[model samples]
Target: MSPTATTPPVLTSVQIPCCVCGTMILPNAANQCPTCLAQEFNLTERLQRGPAGQKHIVIHQCRNCRRFARTPTRYEFAEHESPELLSICLKHIPALNQHDLQLVDASWIWTEPHCMRLKVRLTVRTELLSVVVQQRVMVELHVQFQMCPECNRDFTNRTWHALVQVRQVRNDSKKGLAALEMALAKNKTIRQHVLKVDTKKNGFDFYFLSNTHAQTFTNFLQRVAAMRIQRTTKMVSADNHSNTANMKTTFMAQMVPLCRDDLVLIHRKAAGSKLAGSLAIVTKVSSTIQFVGASPKRTHVSDSMMELSADQYYKTEKHYQMLQAGHRLVRFVVLDVELCDEQAPSGQLYEGPHSGVEKYALADVTVARESDFGVNDEMFACVTHLGHWIAAGDVVLGYDLVNSVGTDDWEMQEQLHGGFTLPDVVLVKKAPRNKETAAVGVDEQEGQKRMTKKRERRKRYKEGRKQKELEETAGRMGFFDDINEEQVDEEGEDVDADFEAELANDPELAAELLNLERDLAQLDDGDVVAEGEDNQLVEEDNQDS
Candidate 1:
């Protein structure tokens, strides 16, 4: 078939006069020139009469926490170029909700951060008289420093609606308290509710904004450690007309007196006929206390350890006495270890509650006091459950019952139990190496250098106390500014060498501490940026038109 002949259509231009200026323009729906239409629909003038009817929009910002408030009811933590900040800016422009007007694009504008000004450029489109009009409008946000209600209450010493007083029954050893602190710091769900954490002489005092938070924290503590809680409430204020009263609740959590490696003399009646011996050493401390008999005669029965619940321990706490506290444990060097025969079935294994997947083998270990290693030839032999971890030449902490002073109750118990005799030494866990000493050799100059470095770290830690408090306060208020990864790496490297050494032995604990450290570093970096420094205005060039 022959293709139809085609001819090019001629393009025609029709001129039209501007409605206001009477200027000739291309034929279009508006029937007006570009200049007259632009003058009639002045974006800047229309924006002046829009929802935000001023050239400068005042944004209330908390001076202490650095959070912004767009309205009186709510405060938010928004970062530059973030969707949250964009939404906050758009909320001020109510004209965008009109049927004809539509939001085309929005973006942030860079300005001097120190000037406390934020600028946003918004592109909007609208239909008028069968014509489409698009315009870009600039909005200036003036930040006003104001203390929020929370900060004001904090400054007035009324920050907490509930107080948790955490105390340990035995204050001589801080091991239990340290573990409790770690537990509190690692749990993000619980830490978010904590307003302030104060270190007391015996333990820590946690403050919460609400009584429910305090109760949640107390329950968390019970799950992590062996502790008993007592609750009380006091009326803070009362309104007779409304029949309303504001009450502040207080929770007193007392941790168990016994800690890991503690040597205890249990009363025969308190033992409840389940325990074979009165003398035992604490093997683990969690929601419940686990103890293994330390008497030489009961070495065969050590595998079947006794468990003491928190409630039972508290009920009979007066009947039990600590013979040797963990803090007074003596250092011992392992001279030899002989693994005992496995008595369990071929497929069966004995695992303690806190052991997790670890498998322990009983062994007879010969140890000598580290102090008397070369000075004297005295040695002691004992049975320990750490056969999988302990080896010759390893240093460990143990109770030296030979030289330990016994209480009157302990002496009487010993006299009554003629058949049972306490072992000369009871070994606990392996000792954590001293990083300060291990890093430097025996050279005096190296030791001096290490000391100087330790002193410097201490000085830096002390100097940053005020700044840390501010950062911690901001963190509790759910405000975390943007942070650089490099800053985080640097902060992570400065961890205490001793703490690092201790954490090396417990991978799970180390992981928890790592999370805690990362969170703290982010808080620290945010505070550093907020304190008299230029705000980080992220420049984002990607915008839809």
Candidate 2:
């Protein structure tokens, strides 16, 4: 026997259930066992259940799944733990997730299973906060209008527009806007009203929630502004005329309305051509009230223009002054306005704080109708006067003012020197008794400002002076001004010693006192002498006997 061939020691085979398959796989097989490789588990279940008794580990289970293919111990779980710990443990699992979580954090994912759809709401409170919403720098804006902001009791406008800059949280997102609206609806201060919502490019978004008299808000003003369509850019000057020191900013717009027939007039002018983009509201003082009628001649322009809503169009000072006039809000049906053929420019009431014509001056308006209107740059037809004093109907195209755009408010008397340029058809109402608005002199405003400033400065100065005087007086009184302290005992002793020294230095008094002392000494001596004399006398008597 050729030395019996040693049999290779057979290795014990340990089978491991494939994580991917339900079948046991041999350790030495080059390929995964087909049965073990085909195993599957419910993913959602893997994220549901947490680790046993571990606070950080939550095993997650699928709603419809129970086990991993045929394996009994395989399932999904979601764990709850701190983000710091999860980062250390889940360092190897490749994953990407947008966590919708409230109290639960990412670290929880490391504890056995971390796959739970979480929804959460958080509320945060802070002290000494930044008050982010209130720090905005804003401008106060005014636009020429034929209606009043107060006519409908704009308490909201007044309280919101006061000098204070308010805090606001604005929602630019669609979902946030709806949520904000719902939240505002619950507020007692907010009234219930439905506003239309439109979402489109070149489309305006208008929605707002207002607080009438609130300020120092953490976040709320932007919600209120959204209700209005005007997202305006505003700039402020120094304190305006009002002592209140409010800044002023103005915008351009046209608020007049137009009729169906006017569209035909515009249509005829374009002669069946594209009419939408060609027409623009001309802001020139002379161009503002000029109208184009169906006949295309000197025709009076009515308040009803194509622009449905009131608009502010910057114009010559005259036009601004005119638009600044007192306006009375009148409601008329669309058809009734057409029947009237013309409407009066709402007269501006420059009263109270606005006692004078603003910086804008009166314009040199011509007298004319639609036919007399002149075209400037072939764009807008210029009409001299529709309702102004000249009463003549004339049309002149594009005329530049002395320095600026012409305003329609008041005409300089000099423009009348050339006589009427257009045929006269309508008469401007004769100057009413108080036609000349009481011109509040500019000096009055300036003087008032000076006086107010002077008075304030004087008050502050007086207060400072009084405080300084009191402080000086108090200082003069020395330490402990109220209660006086006793003089030091040493000082009293010195005073007494000085008084005694002065008494001793008195020459006459000292001499008298010295003589008294000499007498007392002689008395003692007298007694002794008296005794001696008696003895001598007695001896003498003895001798004589």
Instruction: Give me the runs in candidate 1 sitting further than 4 Å from their true place.
Output: 1-159, 271-273, 296-303, 342-358, 374-376, 391-394, 407-418, 432-545
Minimum summed lDDT over a 10-residue window in model 2 is located at 328-337
Best by lDDT: 1
How far is 102's C-alpha from truth in model 2 (Å)? 27
**TM-score, predicted candidate 2 vs. hidden true structure:** 0.19
TM-score of each: 0.55, 0.19
Encode model 1's per-residue lDDT on 1-545: one tens digit a residue. Answer: 99999999998897877777888877777787655665578675555344446655667778898877767757788886678877886776656666777888999998876788778888878765656778888867677898877777778876678999988856345567657766655556877777777655466678888888898889888987898889999998999999999998999999888877677777666756245435777878899998876643424544546898888888877666777755455678999977665653332333455644245556788999888866999999877776666778888777777775554344546533556656788876676666333221122354356557766765776546434534443343233334233433244244334344334433445566567678877867787777635433322222321
| Model 2 misplaced stretches (Cα beyond 4 Å) | 1-45, 49-290, 293-312, 320-413, 416-545
